[model samples]
Target: MTDSTAPRGGKRERLVTSAGERLHRKGVAATTLADIAQAADVPVGNVYYYFKTKDDLVRAVLEAQVDQVEAMLASFETLPQPVDRLKALVRRWDEMRDVIARYGCPFGTLASELDRRDDGLDLEAAGPIRRILEWAEIQIRQLGQPDARELAITLFAGVQGGALLAGALRDPNLMSGQVRHLERWIDTVAASSTQS
Candidate 1:
């Protein structure tokens, strides 16, 4: 589904896109408006027209990420089984293993940095993560797990922790190994539920 809130390739969109990438790589504090302008090929003066402050730009980025998370979870709903849908979650991270190894999770890194402050942006930054966790919980519930919340939390922790380790160590293998383990765990859960 198309998101009207999504940036649509104009100067503002370009600025938001650039900011998102830089925020993921260099972080919010380190990424200047000038840096985003240089990346988007827009003049620094023009960025202010779209976003008066860096926080505004970060909000736009978070909005886009929330939409993305929704889209991804919706896509997984097309799968034949809840177990396959759950496995698709880990597979997504596996597909982006190299990029994640370099910069950590896009939503995760931004949220981690923003969470250090008492600002409400902490909740905003975590929107995508919260969405994913909620989606996983539902999928686990579909699999008939009595403790779906706990299972989903374990899955979220494993994926995020794996991403953290991969990024910290600059090794994609950690993410790969983590996803493999998750695949097995999902199978076990699915099998146990069937036998129940």
Candidate 2:
């Protein structure tokens, strides 16, 4: 007999997608396998068929988020100048403001949660967030800064802080300010690199 409870896209993919959405909305600690199962319209047994446990499901969600960032970086990678690539990245964020504003940045939330509770889940969640910072560093390095990595990390912190403030204030413009501040900071780095 066909497994009627099996998710349409297949168990693993559906579970990951559902888990990611729930994790984004309710956070990793707050999200339960049962919640994911309900979101995916599958049974708990089917969810278990894919993810052995909640941590396994969290890892899958983080992996998907990393894949998404990698896809985003692909387009930015080809830009001839690092500063131009940085600008393009900011522009892309402007386009994503609606979802980002509503969800409060999944990667940011994941990073915050990881800080609060360190575990295997932190390993999974922190990797993607680190990759984003690494990408920023790569762009910053193009400007020939002596401390590109440090600058990148600083910029990432600013963005995350801005996102938190925006979400707390419930103001989309506040969230966009984070992107704006980052862009301005990057421009200064680029200018200084050129003059030095």
TM-score of each: 0.94, 0.87
Query: What residue runs in model 2 are displaced by over 4 Å at the alpha carbon?
Result: 1-8
Pick out the ten consecutive residues of candidate 2 with the lowest summed lDDT. Answer: 1-10
Write down the lDDT that model 2 would get: 0.78
Model 1 spans with C-alpha error above 4 angstroms: 1-9, 194-196
Q: Tell me the deviation in Å of residue 129 in model 2.
A: 1.4
Tens digit of lDDT per residue, candidate 1, span 89-153?
Answer: 99999999999999999988999999887778887777899999999999999888989999999
Cα lDDT tens digits, model 2, 150-194, are 988887777677767766777778768778877888788898895
The TM-score between candidate 1 and the true structure equals: 0.94
lDDT of 2 at 186: 78
